[model samples]
Each structure stands twice: as structure tokens, then as C-alpha cells.
Target chain A: MNIVVIDYGMGNIRSIQSSLLYLGVKSVIVSSDRNDILKADKIILPGVGAFGEAVREIKKRNLEKHLAEAVLKDGKPILGICLGMQLLGLSSEEGGFNKGLNFVNGVVTKLYGEGIKIPHVGFNQIQVNENSRLYNGLNSEPDFYFTHSFKMTSEDDIGASHCVYGSRFVASFENNNVAGVQFHPELSQNNGLRLLKNFIERF
Target chain B: MLRKRIIFTLIHSDGYFMQSRNFRLQKVGNLLWLEKNYKFQHISFSLDELIILDATRNQKNLSQFASIVSGVVNDVFIPVAAGGGIRSLADADLLFKSGADKIVLNSLQYENPLIVRELVEKYGSQSIIASVDYKSTAEGHLVYVNDGSKKIEYSLKEYLTYLEDLGVGEIYLNSIDKDGTGFGYDLETILNVKDLLSIPLIIAGGAGNEKHLLEGLKTDGIAAVATANLFNFIGDGLPNARNHIISLGENIANWNANS
Candidate 1:
């Protein structure tokens, strides 16, 4: 399968690439080239950094337009992980009010609740939706590694899996061909591998 | 629900991985020996996170360490946090490119507050971990840096507050006295300072067995427990401990390793 990992010059791209390699994917490309991303069978948006800076880098590299065209227009399946997932939302409150790629219907905001630690790090159980294509072949409640302060919430009927830290937040969302996970599936072991396989084969 | 974590720390020095005791290092073996003994590709399934720290006391090599990180992370699907001698954005960038999901900082959190601020601004707090090594004294817990060679003025509590204000993502508290002793964690010290933390806390040092790991994980306010004792957790040791911990009802991530 032709899998292209969108690189905006941030986050651990190597780990994602290594995970794909371990999964026996023969054609995984980490590139920012417009044509490479547009022609891929699937695209993985992987990021680890501030939303504003990440969005800025994406815009600077002109990946925003191509990504919109590839995922929104052509209906290619896209998987956004961690900061990449947050970048799919309408906006984020981190690093001031920053706009996202708006591929999914949501707003990223700081996690607000009493007695919860900031940057909620570690393995947390997620309530996976039964019909979620991203969670196919997984257990009812799967655990994924998450390390983020800002979380996504939506008013629309976006199929979201919920995880509670201080409050309920969108851990992963499925909206047609565009899917985003707040956790790092590449680092989440077997459950993660299963989820990524579902995205690659079932999506 | 956010579950607790069991982190495995690997101490790399020069071209060999070392076993540390009371902040003193003893060379264990090279990367080949490590791969043969630990087989991280299999053991990583039992861990929630992996932290690799370069503890070379003299003439630390950044590129070589990065290469080792890159080599070991292959096929080992788990969050890897690498640090040691990361002084610049380029160094952090190199580690990220090499496969580090998060960068752990020690001396720079004090020596270069501005760079820490820049990192926080660029990567956000969740991508940076502040590692504080301390030794308990008559006055209180005294913070140490530079591989525990230099002692800083701030007490453990004061230093943690400083780190929090500096906007680090998490705090890794390691006890210099209890390190590698197998006596279990210094739970008293953790309880004393647990209330002062606003970020996630990872406690390290003196974990020699599964019971010790369980004791650390069962404590309230402790987010994760880390062990760097390689010889103690070799072969199927880690997987067995993980199964035991899960059977004991501690909430940790479970996955089918055979799958």
C-alpha cells in the first residue's frame, strides 16, 4: 500500500516510520511534497509540538492547501496523531488563539477540570465507539499513550471515543475518511498496531 | 481514566550501557550485549514508556548516542524519551529525528532557563521532562546536577517549584541514595513532596523487584515508576512483573504481546 506520512518538520517522524516498517508496510514515505501526498493511498499526519507553531510550519511549507485538497476533496483516508490530530480541529487555545486545518469539526482548548495534572501523560483507557473504523478488531476499551495539555471538543456529531483525565475529552474521532487520535498510536504497542492496521486496511 | 505507568530507563555511557548505583556508574555492556540480554523488541511490550539517558561522565558523544537511540528504538513500539547532553535546539532536533518522542532535560533546566523556555514555547510542556536527582540530607532533600557531581542550592521542593514555573512537562525525581539499592522507593520523600507538584511525577531509584515496583505504583500522586536496573529485570522478568502488577489490580495498559 502507498502510505505517505505528512512531515511539517516537527515531531518524531522516525518512530512513526519505524512502526510502519515493523508492520510490514513496504511503501511508506515521509514527505512534504505535494504530489507524493496527493497520490498516496493513505496519509498519516504525525506531529509533536505546539499547535500554533505546527500550523505555522505546515502553512510555511504550503502543506495545508495540498492536505485539504487530498483529504477533503479527493476523500483520501487521513490519520492525524497527537498534535497532528489537534491541528485537524478548528482552533487551539495553546500558544494564544491559533487556527487549525479545520478538517474536523472541533475546537482545541486547555484541559479544564479540578485535581487533574497538566499534560496528562501515560496510558489511559479509551471508550471506543462500536462502529469506529479506526478501532476495528480492538477491545471494547483500549489503552493508548497520551501526553498533551490541550484537548479537542466538538458540538457536532463527530464519532469520538472518550477518555477522562480531569474531564471527558475526545481521545479519537472518526468522520468519514478523516480520522484523528489524540494519543500516539505508533507508541501504543499492540493496541496501537491494531488501530493503525485498521486505518490502513479498513478505512 | 488515566492509568499509571511503568517506565524502563536505560543508562548509556560512552559506547556501553552502565549500571548506576548511588549515582556512580559501572559499565555493563555495549549495545550488542544490551540487545542480546534485554531483547527490547519483546520486553518493550511490557512497558508503558522507555527513557534512555546518556550518563557518560567524560567527553560525551551526542551523535553516537543518537545512533544508539535510533538503533534500539527500531521495532520497539513504545513512547521513547531520550536525553543527556541536550543543550541546544539542534541537539533536541537530532534526537527527535533519531526517534525520541520526548526530550528529558537535567542540567539545562537550571543552566539555561531561556533555552528551556524556548523549548517549551516550540514543543509545548508535554514534550519536555525535567529530571531532578536528589540526595536526602539532615536539612532536606538536596538537588544535584551534572551527573550528581555538582550540588545545587535549591532544596528538592524549591527546585520542583522552579521547574514547574519554568513550564516543563513532567518531573522525574530520582533519589541518589536509594539508587540501585533494591530497597524499594523512598516513599517518605515522595509523600512529602507530592503535594507540591502540579505536573505528572515519575519516581525512580531503588526498584529491584516487582514488589518494589508495585509499592511505587500504588502510592497516590505518583504518576509513573521507573527502574534502570538492567540485571534485575532481564529476560522475561519485565513481562512477569507486568502480569503480576495487573493481577494485583493496579490500572496499567494491557496488550497481547503474542499478537
Candidate 2:
């Protein structure tokens, strides 16, 4: 399959590429070209860094429209990791309340609570929903690596998986062809690889 | 619940991975030796994270180190943090491009606070790890930089606060006195300074066995425990220790690799 990792120039894209290679994915392309997105069998939107800068790069590279077309119109299976996940939401309060792709109904904000830490790092377990396509074939309460200050949440269902850091928030969500995880599945162990395989095969 | 992490740190010097002790280094093997003996992929199943440091004592070439880092990181699906002589944003960027999930900063944290801030601004705090090496002296716990050779004036606690203020995502507190000694973690000192910062703190040095890992994991306020002792945790040593620690009811995450 032609799996394209959307390169917005702000992601740890190598790890995702390497992980896909380990899963026996052949013909993987890392590109910002719109034609690459148009030709991909699956789309992996991986990102790291601030929301404002990421949005700026995506706009500068003109990936926003192509990404929206592929995931929304073409109905290509798309998975967003960490900051990429936050970008799939409705809006984020990270850097002056910038807008997201609005692929899913959610809002992103700083993770804060009574006595909880910021920039939650390390491996943390997520409570999966019963009908989660992203978590298919994985064991219960699987742990995934997380390193971010902001998290996404919504009043809607959105096929959400929950993790409790400060309070309960969205760990991952799957909405038909669109899916996003607030953790690094590429860096996460077998559970993560299983999730990625599910995205490639089942999604 | 957020599980505590077990990180296996590989100390590299001049194109060879070494066994570090008391701030001194002893070459153990090269990359071929590590993969041939340990099968890093198999051993990685026993770990939540991995840290590779370039203790190259002389002028270090980051691109070469980055290529080595890229070599070790393939097929090992865990977070790898690499650094030692990262003097600029370009150096840190090189490591990240070569497959490092996070950049570990030491002397850069002290000598170049502005560059550290720049890294934090660009990568955000979560991508930067501040590595503070301290030796408990009669004067007090004093900070050391430049591969544990030069001593800085900031007290241990004082320096930690400064790193946090610089918006570092995590603190890698390695005890120069206890590093690779096989004794145990400096729990007393850990307890004293553990509560000072609200961010995640990974305590390293002197973890010889599963019990040592358990002791550190079982403690309060520590997010992770790291060991760079090659002799102690090579071969099946890491997997065995991880199993033993988990069976003892420690909170380290269990992997489903090759299951």
C-alpha cells in the first residue's frame, strides 16, 4: 500500500516511517506535495511542537486543503498522532485560540487540575471504548507514550478513548475515516503497533 | 493510572558503547557487539524508554553520533532520548531528525541558557530533557557539567529550579557518586529534592538489579528509573529484571511485544 506520512516539517516523522517499515509496509512516502496525499492509500498526519507554528507550516506548505480533501472528501483513512490529534479538533486554546481542521468536534486546552503536572510525559494507560476501531485487537487498558501540555475533549461521543491525568480527557477518538490519538503510537510498544496495523487494515 | 517507566541508558564514547561508573567510562562494545549479543529489539520489549548518550570526551561530531543513533533506533519501538555534546539548535535538530524522540541537554542547560530556551520555544517543553549530574560533596550536593568534569556553582536544588524555569519538560537526575556503582539509588537525596518540582523526574545511577528498580519505582514523586550498567542488564538481564519487577507488583507498564 502507498502509505503517505504528511510532512509539515514539524513532526518526528522518522519514527512513524520506521514503525510503518517494521510493520511490513512497503512504498511509504514522506512528502508535503498534494499529489502524494491524493495518491496515498492511507494518510498518517504526525506532528510535534506548538500549535501555532504547526498550523503556520501546514498553511505555508498548503497541506491544509489537500489534507481536508483527502480525509473528508476522498474518505481516505487518516490517523493523527499527539499534536496532530489536537489539530483535528474544532479549536485549541494553545496559542491564542487558533482554529483546527474541525474534522472532529472537540476543543484543545492546557492540561490542568488540582495538583496534576503539565507536559504529561512517559507511558500512560488509556481506557478504551467498546467500539473503538483504533484500539481493535489490543488488550484492555493499553499504555501509550505521551509528551504534551495540551489535551482535547468534547461533549460529543466521537468514538472517544479516555485517560485520566489531571481529570478525564480524550486519549483517542475514531470517527469513521478520521482518527486521532493524543499519544505517540509510533513510539508506543506492541500495543501501539497493533493499533497502527488496525488503522492500516481495518480502517 | 500513569505507570512508572524503566529506561535502559546506553553510554557511548568514541564510536563505542561504554559502561559508566563514578563519572568514569569503560568501553564495553560497539554497535555490532550490542546488536549481536543483546538483540536490542528483544531487550527493548523489557523497557519503556531508552537513553543514548555521547560521552565522546573530545570534539564530537553530532552527525556521526546521529547516524549511530539512527542505527540503534530502528525496529526498537520505544521513545529514544539522545544527547551529550549538543551545542546548538542544529545539533538538537540533527538528533531529532535521526530518530530521537527527545533531546537530552547537560552543559547546554548551564553554559547556554538562551539556546536551551530556544529549544524549548521551538520543540516545546515536552521535547526537551534537562540532564543534571550532581555529586554529593562535603560542601553540599554540587552540580557538574561537561561530562561530569567541570563543576558549576549552582547548588543541586538551585539548578533544578532553574531548568524548570527554563521550561524543560523533564529532569534526568543522575548521581555522579552512584552512577554505575550497583549500590542503589540515592533515595534519601531523592526524597529531599523530589518534592521541589511538580514536573516529571527520572532518577538514574546505581541501579544494579530488579530490586533497585523496584525501590526507585515504589518511591513517591519519581516518574521513572534509569540504569546505564551494561554488565548488569545485558543479554536477558533486562527482560528478566522487568518480569521480576512486574511480578513483585511494581507499576511499570507491561508490553505485549511478540506476544
By DockQ, the best candidate is 1
Q: Write the per-residue lDDT of candidate 1 for residues B131-193, one digit (tens) a residue.
A: 999999898899999999999999899999999999999999999999988888989999999
DockQ of each: 0.74, 0.70
For candidate 2, the per-residue lDDT at B233 reads 86
Runs with alpha carbons beyond 4 Å of true place in candidate 2: B257-259
Return the interface RMSD of the candidates, in order shown, one decimal each.
Answer: 1.5, 1.6
Cα-based lDDT at residue A97, candidate 1: 97
In candidate 1, how many Å is residue B62 off? Answer: 0.9
Worst 10 residues of 1 chain A by lDDT: A129-138
Clashing pairs counted in every model: 0, 0
Docking class of 2: medium
Residue by residue across A34-153, what tens digits does model 1's lDDT show? 999988999999988888889889999999899999999999999999999989989999879999999988999999789889999988889887678887777778888999999999
